[model samples]
Target: MSAADVWPIVKARLELLDDARKPLIETYIAEIEHRMKHYCNIRALPDNLLYVWASMTVDAVRVDLPNADEIADTVGGGANIKVGDTSVSGGSSGSGVTNTSKAVIDQVVLDYRVDLNRYRQMRWGG
Candidate 1:
């Protein structure tokens, strides 16, 4: 299957009903596929790895397009509260944010290392 075939599955996993973010999602899908190809040394993605690719794409999208504002709105916090001489501040747990030094794409690949290994093509040089 091609990357296009995985788009719908990624959308479904992300609960996306509209196509507003289609382009963005597609971009992530391409990058994920590229990394997978490089890591596994495979020319094309096998059908068995479709769901794995979709999952990695979903994770990258979630990290890059985190719904922080929506989450904060729903979980209300007081970041500007002050009481006399004392001051108090609070904010959303920021659980949606992933604190990682690695890029989202790299992290996705690393996260799916085992799955990708199954399809890896070994190479040897003289």
Candidate 2:
């Protein structure tokens, strides 16, 4: 199915202004299509799964949006946040670091019962 076919679901999942998010949504749809293009053995998934994947992609990208402008300045440092006289500071360095967005997306895929291996292309006879 085309991006237009699944746009309503994507929009509802995002819950944002259509004008503000349409470009990003299109980008994600394009990325998904491009990734699947070379995988010859990929199974034909249901439309719901495709919609979920698209929504997940949007969510993954959204997680990074908050830091985009800050990162573009080439200035890196800890974040100092204060709320109601309470202060908190943290940096992007240290151990036990995990990509929370990816983890969450992975969990969502599992919740949806997606078989990720189906997207892989098999090869035989080297």
Candidate 3:
């Protein structure tokens, strides 16, 4: 699909206006990794994830199965456990974690589910 086919349509709908286009990458899938930096805490990875984030656009796309052999080959098919309880209050927040210590993560999770359902609908021609 073309870039113009996807980019401009969603730009007008989103409210907050922060860019949301995730790059089609090969390094590893990006997850919000929070960490402590110099004096203040930073909620990001200390690597090339940010650079990969910008050179893309806010367009939804899909691809085939991953040839990923990283975790499955390295550790006998175990997945990493992400901490924090998914609570009634959404993700959780206190002092020095993520801005996601609030309701944003919760909403994002809900949005993800909705998107997944839409994908299923599109796949099945429903």
lDDT of 2 by residue, 5-119 (tens): 6666666654544356577657766555444433334445445456556654554443333244322122235654222222323333332213453353444344434444555
Residue pair clashes in candidate 3 = 92-101, 93-101
> Judged by lDDT, which candidate is best?
1
Per-residue lDDT over 21-125 for candidate 3, one digit per residue giving the tens place of the 0 to 100 score: 324322112221111111113333234323222222111111111122221222122322122332221111111223342233333333344322322222223
Off by over 4 Å in 1: 68-102
Query: What TM-score, over all chains together, does every model reach?
Result: 0.72, 0.46, 0.18
Instruction: Answer with 2 or 3, whichever has the higher TM-score.
Output: 2
- Superposed Cα deviation of residue 26, candidate 1 (Å): 0.3
Give the lowest summed-lDDT range of ten residues in model 3: 57-66
Model 3 vs. true fold: TM: 0.18
- TM-score leader: 1
User: Which scores better on lDDT, 1 or 3?
Assistant: 1
Error of 2 at 114 (Å): 5.1
